[model samples]
Target: MNQNVLIIGATSGIAEAVARHFAEQGARLFLVARNSEKLQAISADLVARGALEVATFVMNANETDRIPQMTDAAWKVHGTIDVALVAHGTLPDQQRTETNIAYAIAEFRTNAESVIACLAALAQRMEPQGKGVLAVIGSVAGDRGRPGNYLYGAAKAALDTYASGLRARLFKSGVHVLIIKPGFVATAMTVDLNLPARLTATPDRVACDIQLAIAKRRDVLYTPWFWYWIMLIIRWIPAAIFKRMKL
Candidate 1:
Protein backbone atom coordinates (compact mmCIF):
# COMPACT_ATOMS: atom_id res chain seq x y z
CA MET A 1 0.00 0.00 0.00
CA ASN A 2 1.25 3.45 -0.93
CA GLN A 3 0.81 5.44 2.30
CA ASN A 4 0.21 9.15 2.71
CA VAL A 5 3.00 10.49 4.92
CA LEU A 6 3.18 13.98 6.45
CA ILE A 7 6.57 15.16 7.78
CA ILE A 8 6.99 18.38 9.76
CA GLY A 9 10.51 19.88 9.74
CA ALA A 10 11.06 17.87 6.64
CA THR A 11 14.19 19.84 5.78
CA SER A 12 16.03 18.68 8.84
CA GLY A 13 18.79 16.09 8.36
CA ILE A 14 17.00 13.15 10.02
CA ALA A 15 13.58 14.05 8.67
CA GLU A 16 14.94 14.27 5.15
CA ALA A 17 16.44 10.82 5.55
CA VAL A 18 13.09 9.48 6.78
CA ALA A 19 11.36 11.18 3.84
CA ARG A 20 13.73 9.45 1.46
CA HIS A 21 13.08 6.07 3.05
CA PHE A 22 9.33 6.54 2.80
CA ALA A 23 9.68 7.81 -0.74
CA GLU A 24 11.57 4.69 -1.70
CA GLN A 25 8.47 2.79 -0.58
CA GLY A 26 6.36 4.92 -2.97
CA ALA A 27 4.59 6.90 -0.25
CA ARG A 28 2.84 10.17 -1.06
CA LEU A 29 4.49 12.93 0.93
CA PHE A 30 3.37 16.26 2.37
CA LEU A 31 6.50 17.94 3.76
CA VAL A 32 6.46 21.04 5.98
CA ALA A 33 9.49 23.13 6.85
CA ARG A 34 10.45 26.73 7.61
CA ASN A 35 12.79 27.23 4.67
CA SER A 36 11.14 27.51 1.28
CA GLU A 37 14.28 26.73 -0.66
CA LYS A 38 15.17 23.68 1.40
CA LEU A 39 11.60 22.42 1.39
CA GLN A 40 11.45 22.62 -2.39
CA ALA A 41 14.84 20.95 -2.70
CA ILE A 42 13.77 18.07 -0.49
CA SER A 43 10.50 17.73 -2.40
CA ALA A 44 12.37 17.41 -5.67
CA ASP A 45 14.77 14.88 -4.18
CA LEU A 46 11.93 12.78 -2.73
CA VAL A 47 10.17 12.82 -6.10
CA ALA A 48 13.35 11.66 -7.75
CA ARG A 49 13.72 8.96 -5.12
CA GLY A 50 10.36 7.43 -6.12
CA ALA A 51 7.75 9.14 -4.00
CA LEU A 52 4.33 8.70 -5.59
CA GLU A 53 3.60 12.40 -4.93
CA VAL A 54 5.52 15.07 -3.02
CA ALA A 55 4.04 18.34 -1.72
CA THR A 56 5.80 21.08 0.24
CA PHE A 57 4.73 23.69 2.80
CA VAL A 58 6.88 26.48 4.27
CA MET A 59 6.12 27.52 7.83
CA ASN A 60 8.07 28.21 11.00
CA ALA A 61 7.24 25.33 13.30
CA ASN A 62 8.18 27.33 16.40
CA GLU A 63 5.26 29.67 15.73
CA THR A 64 2.89 27.56 17.78
CA ASP A 65 -0.10 29.61 16.61
CA ARG A 66 0.34 28.40 13.02
CA ILE A 67 0.80 24.64 13.62
CA PRO A 68 -2.89 23.75 13.81
CA GLN A 69 -3.52 25.60 10.56
CA MET A 70 -0.50 23.96 8.98
CA THR A 71 -1.56 20.47 10.07
CA ASP A 72 -5.04 21.07 8.74
CA ALA A 73 -3.62 22.23 5.44
CA ALA A 74 -1.43 19.14 5.18
CA TRP A 75 -4.40 16.89 5.92
CA LYS A 76 -6.42 18.62 3.23
CA VAL A 77 -3.67 18.11 0.70
CA HIS A 78 -3.23 14.40 1.44
CA GLY A 79 -6.94 13.64 2.20
CA THR A 80 -5.68 11.81 5.28
CA ILE A 81 -2.17 11.44 6.68
CA ASP A 82 -1.42 7.76 7.30
CA VAL A 83 1.79 8.75 9.09
CA ALA A 84 3.03 11.99 10.71
CA LEU A 85 6.47 12.86 12.08
CA VAL A 86 7.38 15.98 14.03
CA ALA A 87 11.17 16.51 13.80
CA HIS A 88 12.18 20.13 14.32
CA GLY A 89 14.25 21.36 17.27
CA THR A 90 17.38 23.29 18.22
CA LEU A 91 20.30 22.44 20.48
CA PRO A 92 20.63 25.57 22.57
CA ASP A 93 23.87 26.59 24.29
CA GLN A 94 23.43 25.44 27.85
CA GLN A 95 25.47 28.17 29.54
CA ARG A 96 23.84 30.89 27.53
CA THR A 97 20.35 29.60 28.23
CA GLU A 98 21.08 29.17 31.92
CA THR A 99 22.06 32.83 32.31
CA ASN A 100 19.41 34.28 30.02
CA ILE A 101 15.98 33.48 31.40
CA ALA A 102 14.07 34.83 28.42
CA TYR A 103 16.22 32.87 26.00
CA ALA A 104 15.64 29.74 28.03
CA ILE A 105 11.87 30.18 27.82
CA ALA A 106 12.07 30.81 24.09
CA GLU A 107 14.03 27.60 23.66
CA PHE A 108 11.45 25.73 25.68
CA ARG A 109 8.67 27.13 23.53
CA THR A 110 10.45 26.04 20.39
CA ASN A 111 11.40 22.53 21.46
CA ALA A 112 8.47 21.61 23.71
CA GLU A 113 5.41 23.81 23.17
CA SER A 114 5.60 23.75 19.40
CA VAL A 115 5.94 19.95 19.32
CA ILE A 116 2.96 19.52 21.65
CA ALA A 117 0.92 21.84 19.47
CA CYS A 118 1.76 19.90 16.34
CA LEU A 119 0.96 16.57 18.01
CA ALA A 120 -2.35 17.84 19.30
CA ALA A 121 -3.32 19.11 15.87
CA LEU A 122 -2.47 15.79 14.22
CA ALA A 123 -4.13 13.79 17.00
CA GLN A 124 -7.40 15.68 16.64
CA ARG A 125 -7.65 14.87 12.94
CA MET A 126 -6.41 11.27 13.25
CA GLU A 127 -8.81 10.43 16.08
CA PRO A 128 -11.74 10.81 13.75
CA GLN A 129 -10.02 8.78 11.03
CA GLY A 130 -9.45 5.89 13.53
CA LYS A 131 -6.00 4.87 12.26
CA GLY A 132 -2.65 6.61 11.74
CA VAL A 133 0.91 6.80 13.04
CA LEU A 134 2.07 9.90 14.93
CA ALA A 135 5.79 9.95 15.66
CA VAL A 136 8.21 12.53 17.07
CA ILE A 137 12.03 12.62 17.10
CA GLY A 138 13.00 13.12 20.71
CA SER A 139 16.43 12.90 22.43
CA VAL A 140 17.84 10.56 25.05
CA ALA A 141 19.13 13.62 26.85
CA GLY A 142 15.59 13.87 28.15
CA ASP A 143 16.01 10.60 30.02
CA ARG A 144 18.01 12.48 32.62
CA GLY A 145 19.04 16.12 32.89
CA ARG A 146 22.74 16.88 32.99
CA PRO A 147 24.69 20.10 33.57
CA GLY A 148 25.91 20.23 29.95
CA ASN A 149 22.58 20.47 28.14
CA TYR A 150 19.89 20.46 30.76
CA LEU A 151 17.80 23.06 28.93
CA TYR A 152 17.46 20.95 25.82
CA GLY A 153 17.08 17.80 27.93
CA ALA A 154 14.29 19.33 30.00
CA ALA A 155 12.36 20.34 26.90
CA LYS A 156 12.67 16.85 25.43
CA ALA A 157 11.68 15.35 28.77
CA ALA A 158 8.47 17.36 28.63
CA LEU A 159 7.86 16.12 25.10
CA ASP A 160 8.50 12.54 26.19
CA THR A 161 5.83 12.85 28.85
CA TYR A 162 3.44 14.45 26.40
CA ALA A 163 3.97 11.64 23.88
CA SER A 164 3.33 9.03 26.57
CA GLY A 165 0.04 10.64 27.50
CA LEU A 166 -1.00 10.97 23.88
CA ARG A 167 -0.12 7.34 23.20
CA ALA A 168 -2.37 6.16 26.04
CA ARG A 169 -5.27 8.31 24.88
CA LEU A 170 -4.91 7.29 21.24
CA PHE A 171 -4.30 3.55 21.78
CA LYS A 172 -7.98 2.58 21.88
CA SER A 173 -8.64 4.84 18.90
CA GLY A 174 -5.95 3.05 16.83
CA VAL A 175 -3.82 6.17 16.43
CA HIS A 176 -0.34 5.04 17.41
CA VAL A 177 1.78 7.77 19.00
CA LEU A 178 5.51 6.95 18.91
CA ILE A 179 8.41 8.66 20.60
CA ILE A 180 11.89 8.08 19.12
CA LYS A 181 14.79 9.00 21.38
CA PRO A 182 18.13 9.46 19.67
CA GLY A 183 21.36 9.71 21.61
CA PHE A 184 24.02 11.64 19.64
CA VAL A 185 23.22 12.20 16.00
CA ALA A 186 25.93 13.70 13.84
CA THR A 187 23.99 16.22 11.81
CA ALA A 188 24.57 19.85 10.95
CA MET A 189 22.74 20.61 14.16
CA THR A 190 25.48 18.90 16.16
CA VAL A 191 28.50 19.51 13.95
CA ASP A 192 30.24 21.87 16.34
CA LEU A 193 29.41 20.03 19.51
CA ASN A 194 32.04 17.89 21.19
CA LEU A 195 30.76 14.35 20.98
CA PRO A 196 32.13 10.86 20.64
CA ALA A 197 31.95 9.85 17.00
CA ARG A 198 31.71 6.19 17.98
CA LEU A 199 28.57 6.83 19.98
CA THR A 200 26.87 9.02 17.36
CA ALA A 201 24.62 7.81 14.56
CA THR A 202 23.99 9.05 11.03
CA PRO A 203 20.63 10.28 9.79
CA ASP A 204 20.20 7.25 7.57
CA ARG A 205 20.81 4.88 10.46
CA VAL A 206 18.27 6.67 12.62
CA ALA A 207 15.85 6.70 9.70
CA CYS A 208 16.00 2.91 9.52
CA ASP A 209 15.16 2.69 13.20
CA ILE A 210 12.19 4.99 12.66
CA GLN A 211 10.92 2.85 9.81
CA LEU A 212 10.96 -0.26 11.99
CA ALA A 213 9.27 1.59 14.86
CA ILE A 214 6.46 2.80 12.61
CA ALA A 215 6.03 -0.64 11.05
CA LYS A 216 5.80 -2.27 14.47
CA ARG A 217 3.62 0.56 15.88
CA ARG A 218 5.94 0.96 18.85
CA ASP A 219 5.01 3.38 21.64
CA VAL A 220 8.55 4.43 22.65
CA LEU A 221 11.91 3.69 21.06
CA TYR A 222 15.55 4.50 21.80
CA THR A 223 17.54 4.60 18.60
CA PRO A 224 20.78 2.55 18.16
CA TRP A 225 19.20 0.22 20.77
CA PHE A 226 22.27 0.55 23.01
CA TRP A 227 20.98 3.85 24.29
CA TYR A 228 18.34 1.90 26.11
CA TRP A 229 20.94 0.24 28.31
CA ILE A 230 23.05 3.42 28.50
CA MET A 231 20.09 5.37 29.77
CA LEU A 232 19.24 2.55 32.10
CA ILE A 233 22.62 2.86 33.80
CA ILE A 234 22.31 6.64 33.96
CA ARG A 235 18.85 6.53 35.41
CA TRP A 236 19.91 3.87 37.87
CA ILE A 237 22.64 6.03 39.40
CA PRO A 238 21.98 7.38 42.88
CA ALA A 239 20.98 11.02 42.99
CA ALA A 240 23.96 12.06 45.15
CA ILE A 241 26.54 10.50 42.82
CA PHE A 242 24.72 11.56 39.67
CA LYS A 243 24.51 15.15 40.86
CA ARG A 244 28.23 15.43 41.56
CA MET A 245 29.41 13.88 38.31
CA LYS A 246 29.74 15.86 35.08
CA LEU A 247 27.84 14.37 32.19
Candidate 2:
Protein backbone atom coordinates (compact mmCIF):
# COMPACT_ATOMS: atom_id res chain seq x y z
CA MET A 1 0.00 0.00 0.00
CA ASN A 2 2.99 2.34 -0.27
CA GLN A 3 1.40 3.90 -3.33
CA ASN A 4 1.19 7.54 -4.30
CA VAL A 5 -2.17 8.86 -3.00
CA LEU A 6 -4.08 12.13 -3.33
CA ILE A 7 -6.99 13.10 -1.08
CA ILE A 8 -8.94 16.23 -1.89
CA GLY A 9 -10.78 17.49 1.19
CA ALA A 10 -8.04 16.00 3.34
CA THR A 11 -9.49 17.64 6.44
CA SER A 12 -12.93 16.02 6.11
CA GLY A 13 -13.75 13.38 8.70
CA ILE A 14 -14.07 10.61 6.12
CA ALA A 15 -11.08 11.86 4.13
CA GLU A 16 -8.91 12.02 7.23
CA ALA A 17 -9.81 8.47 8.17
CA VAL A 18 -8.90 7.26 4.67
CA ALA A 19 -5.63 9.22 4.86
CA ARG A 20 -4.81 7.61 8.17
CA HIS A 21 -5.38 4.16 6.72
CA PHE A 22 -3.05 4.91 3.81
CA ALA A 23 -0.51 6.50 6.12
CA GLU A 24 -0.42 3.36 8.23
CA GLN A 25 0.41 1.51 5.03
CA GLY A 26 3.33 3.91 4.47
CA ALA A 27 1.74 5.54 1.42
CA ARG A 28 3.03 8.81 -0.05
CA LEU A 29 0.23 11.40 0.20
CA PHE A 30 -0.71 14.74 -1.33
CA LEU A 31 -3.51 16.43 0.62
CA VAL A 32 -5.83 19.31 -0.37
CA ALA A 33 -8.37 21.20 1.73
CA ARG A 34 -9.49 24.74 2.47
CA ASN A 35 -7.82 25.22 5.81
CA SER A 36 -4.08 25.81 5.67
CA GLU A 37 -3.42 25.14 9.33
CA LYS A 38 -5.55 22.01 9.39
CA LEU A 39 -3.90 20.75 6.22
CA GLN A 40 -0.42 21.19 7.67
CA ALA A 41 -1.43 19.57 10.94
CA ILE A 42 -2.92 16.50 9.26
CA SER A 43 0.11 16.20 6.99
CA ALA A 44 2.41 16.22 10.02
CA ASP A 45 0.24 13.71 11.87
CA LEU A 46 0.14 11.33 8.90
CA VAL A 47 3.89 11.58 8.42
CA ALA A 48 4.38 10.82 12.10
CA ARG A 49 2.04 7.86 11.76
CA GLY A 50 4.28 6.31 9.06
CA ALA A 51 3.28 7.99 5.79
CA LEU A 52 6.42 7.92 3.61
CA GLU A 53 5.98 11.63 2.78
CA VAL A 54 3.12 14.16 2.73
CA ALA A 55 2.47 17.26 0.59
CA THR A 56 -0.46 19.69 0.97
CA PHE A 57 -2.32 22.57 -0.69
CA VAL A 58 -4.90 24.95 0.74
CA MET A 59 -7.85 25.76 -1.55
CA ASN A 60 -11.60 26.02 -1.14
CA ALA A 61 -12.87 23.18 -3.30
CA ASN A 62 -15.90 25.24 -4.32
CA GLU A 63 -13.61 27.28 -6.50
CA THR A 64 -13.92 25.09 -9.57
CA ASP A 65 -11.43 27.19 -11.51
CA ARG A 66 -8.68 26.23 -9.09
CA ILE A 67 -9.26 22.50 -9.43
CA PRO A 68 -7.04 21.92 -12.46
CA GLN A 69 -4.15 23.65 -10.77
CA MET A 70 -4.70 21.56 -7.66
CA THR A 71 -4.76 18.34 -9.63
CA ASP A 72 -1.60 19.28 -11.48
CA ALA A 73 0.16 20.00 -8.18
CA ALA A 74 -0.75 16.57 -6.80
CA TRP A 75 0.46 14.78 -9.91
CA LYS A 76 3.69 16.80 -9.98
CA VAL A 77 4.52 15.85 -6.42
CA HIS A 78 3.55 12.18 -6.60
CA GLY A 79 4.43 11.43 -10.30
CA THR A 80 1.71 8.79 -10.36
CA ILE A 81 -1.38 8.93 -8.19
CA ASP A 82 -2.13 5.28 -7.47
CA VAL A 83 -5.31 6.36 -5.72
CA ALA A 84 -7.17 9.67 -5.60
CA LEU A 85 -10.23 10.39 -3.45
CA VAL A 86 -12.51 13.41 -3.81
CA ALA A 87 -14.30 13.79 -0.48
CA HIS A 88 -15.35 17.39 0.11
CA GLY A 89 -19.03 18.25 0.73
CA THR A 90 -21.40 20.13 2.99
CA LEU A 91 -24.56 18.86 4.67
CA PRO A 92 -26.81 21.89 4.42
CA ASP A 93 -29.97 22.49 6.42
CA GLN A 94 -32.91 20.95 4.61
CA GLN A 95 -35.42 23.30 6.15
CA ARG A 96 -33.48 26.42 5.25
CA THR A 97 -32.87 25.23 1.71
CA GLU A 98 -36.58 24.76 1.20
CA THR A 99 -37.11 28.50 1.38
CA ASN A 100 -33.72 30.05 0.62
CA ILE A 101 -33.14 29.46 -3.07
CA ALA A 102 -29.69 30.99 -2.99
CA TYR A 103 -28.53 28.73 -0.17
CA ALA A 104 -29.98 25.69 -1.90
CA ILE A 105 -28.14 26.50 -5.13
CA ALA A 106 -24.90 26.99 -3.29
CA GLU A 107 -25.30 23.72 -1.42
CA PHE A 108 -25.93 21.91 -4.69
CA ARG A 109 -22.82 23.49 -6.17
CA THR A 110 -20.78 22.46 -3.17
CA ASN A 111 -21.95 18.88 -3.25
CA ALA A 112 -22.30 18.33 -7.00
CA GLU A 113 -20.76 20.93 -9.27
CA SER A 114 -17.46 21.17 -7.47
CA VAL A 115 -17.12 17.41 -7.42
CA ILE A 116 -17.72 17.26 -11.17
CA ALA A 117 -15.02 19.85 -11.67
CA CYS A 118 -12.54 17.85 -9.65
CA LEU A 119 -13.48 14.63 -11.40
CA ALA A 120 -12.92 16.18 -14.81
CA ALA A 121 -9.48 17.42 -13.80
CA LEU A 122 -8.44 14.12 -12.25
CA ALA A 123 -9.87 11.98 -15.03
CA GLN A 124 -7.83 13.76 -17.67
CA ARG A 125 -4.67 12.99 -15.71
CA MET A 126 -5.53 9.39 -14.81
CA GLU A 127 -6.72 8.45 -18.32
CA PRO A 128 -3.29 9.20 -19.70
CA GLN A 129 -1.51 7.23 -16.99
CA GLY A 130 -3.65 4.21 -18.01
CA LYS A 131 -4.00 2.96 -14.43
CA GLY A 132 -5.19 4.20 -11.05
CA VAL A 133 -8.18 4.15 -8.72
CA LEU A 134 -10.48 7.19 -8.82
CA ALA A 135 -12.95 7.16 -5.99
CA VAL A 136 -15.52 9.56 -4.56
CA ILE A 137 -17.63 9.52 -1.42
CA GLY A 138 -21.22 9.34 -2.67
CA SER A 139 -24.17 8.51 -0.39
CA VAL A 140 -26.99 5.93 -0.18
CA ALA A 141 -29.43 8.81 -0.17
CA GLY A 142 -28.70 9.12 -3.88
CA ASP A 143 -30.62 5.96 -4.63
CA ARG A 144 -33.86 7.87 -4.29
CA GLY A 145 -35.02 11.25 -3.09
CA ARG A 146 -36.78 11.51 0.25
CA PRO A 147 -38.72 14.43 1.60
CA GLY A 148 -36.27 14.82 4.44
CA ASN A 149 -33.23 15.36 2.24
CA TYR A 150 -33.99 15.28 -1.44
CA LEU A 151 -31.76 18.22 -2.18
CA TYR A 152 -28.73 16.49 -0.76
CA GLY A 153 -29.80 13.20 -2.28
CA ALA A 154 -30.11 14.77 -5.70
CA ALA A 155 -26.56 16.08 -5.48
CA LYS A 156 -25.13 12.68 -4.62
CA ALA A 157 -27.24 11.14 -7.36
CA ALA A 158 -25.56 13.41 -9.84
CA LEU A 159 -22.15 12.20 -8.70
CA ASP A 160 -23.20 8.58 -8.86
CA THR A 161 -24.35 8.96 -12.45
CA TYR A 162 -21.29 10.98 -13.42
CA ALA A 163 -18.96 8.42 -11.92
CA SER A 164 -20.80 5.59 -13.66
CA GLY A 165 -20.30 7.24 -17.02
CA LEU A 166 -16.69 8.07 -16.28
CA ARG A 167 -16.07 4.50 -15.18
CA ALA A 168 -17.12 3.21 -18.58
CA ARG A 169 -15.05 5.82 -20.37
CA LEU A 170 -11.90 4.95 -18.45
CA PHE A 171 -12.30 1.19 -18.60
CA LYS A 172 -10.26 0.85 -21.79
CA SER A 173 -7.50 2.86 -20.20
CA GLY A 174 -7.17 0.41 -17.29
CA VAL A 175 -8.42 2.96 -14.79
CA HIS A 176 -10.95 2.01 -12.14
CA VAL A 177 -13.58 4.51 -11.05
CA LEU A 178 -15.35 3.78 -7.78
CA ILE A 179 -18.36 5.47 -6.24
CA ILE A 180 -18.71 4.98 -2.49
CA LYS A 181 -22.25 4.99 -1.13
CA PRO A 182 -22.01 5.30 2.61
CA GLY A 183 -24.99 5.12 4.92
CA PHE A 184 -25.08 7.03 8.18
CA VAL A 185 -21.57 7.84 9.39
CA ALA A 186 -20.70 9.31 12.75
CA THR A 187 -18.77 12.23 11.36
CA ALA A 188 -18.63 15.89 12.45
CA MET A 189 -21.00 16.70 9.58
CA THR A 190 -23.79 14.54 10.98
CA VAL A 191 -23.46 14.90 14.75
CA ASP A 192 -26.82 16.59 15.09
CA LEU A 193 -28.72 13.93 13.12
CA ASN A 194 -28.34 11.40 15.94
CA LEU A 195 -28.25 8.57 13.44
CA PRO A 196 -29.01 5.10 14.71
CA ALA A 197 -25.89 3.48 16.11
CA ARG A 198 -26.65 0.18 14.50
CA LEU A 199 -26.91 1.76 11.04
CA THR A 200 -24.19 4.32 11.45
CA ALA A 201 -20.62 3.33 10.59
CA THR A 202 -17.48 4.90 11.99
CA PRO A 203 -15.22 6.73 9.56
CA ASP A 204 -12.53 4.13 10.23
CA ARG A 205 -14.90 1.38 9.20
CA VAL A 206 -15.83 3.19 5.99
CA ALA A 207 -12.17 3.80 5.22
CA CYS A 208 -11.37 0.14 5.73
CA ASP A 209 -14.15 -0.85 3.35
CA ILE A 210 -12.89 1.68 0.81
CA GLN A 211 -9.38 0.27 0.97
CA LEU A 212 -10.70 -3.18 0.12
CA ALA A 213 -12.91 -1.89 -2.68
CA ILE A 214 -10.01 -0.10 -4.30
CA ALA A 215 -7.86 -3.21 -4.02
CA LYS A 216 -10.64 -5.20 -5.64
CA ARG A 217 -11.34 -2.50 -8.25
CA ARG A 218 -15.04 -2.60 -7.46
CA ASP A 219 -17.26 -0.13 -9.34
CA VAL A 220 -19.63 0.80 -6.53
CA LEU A 221 -19.36 0.15 -2.81
CA TYR A 222 -22.06 0.09 -0.17
CA THR A 223 -20.13 0.33 3.06
CA PRO A 224 -21.29 -1.84 5.97
CA TRP A 225 -22.90 -3.98 3.20
CA PHE A 226 -26.47 -3.67 4.54
CA TRP A 227 -27.14 -0.25 3.03
CA TYR A 228 -27.33 -1.80 -0.41
CA TRP A 229 -30.35 -3.82 0.65
CA ILE A 230 -31.92 -0.91 2.45
CA MET A 231 -31.63 1.40 -0.54
CA LEU A 232 -32.87 -1.35 -2.84
CA ILE A 233 -36.08 -1.59 -0.87
CA ILE A 234 -36.48 2.16 -0.92
CA ARG A 235 -35.88 2.36 -4.65
CA TRP A 236 -38.41 -0.36 -5.40
CA ILE A 237 -41.24 1.20 -3.46
CA PRO A 238 -44.03 2.43 -5.76
CA ALA A 239 -44.49 6.17 -6.05
CA ALA A 240 -48.09 6.16 -4.74
CA ILE A 241 -47.49 4.43 -1.42
CA PHE A 242 -43.92 5.62 -1.03
CA LYS A 243 -44.94 9.24 -1.47
CA ARG A 244 -47.65 8.87 1.16
CA MET A 245 -45.35 7.40 3.78
CA LYS A 246 -42.57 9.33 5.48
CA LEU A 247 -39.06 8.03 4.79
TM-score of each candidate?
0.98, 0.98
Q: How would you encode candidate 1's per-residue C-alpha lDDT over 6-39 as one tens digit per residue?
A: 9998888899999999999999999998899988
> Model 2: per-residue lDDT, tens digit, 169-247?
9999999999999999999899899788888999999999999999999999999899999989998999999999887
* Top candidate, metric lDDT: 2
lDDT of every predicted structure (CA atoms): 0.92, 0.94
| Model 1 lDDT, residue 180, Cα | 96
Full-model lDDT, candidate 2: 0.94
Superposing all C-alpha atoms, what RMSD in Å does each candidate have to the true structure? 0.8, 0.8
lDDT of 1: 0.92
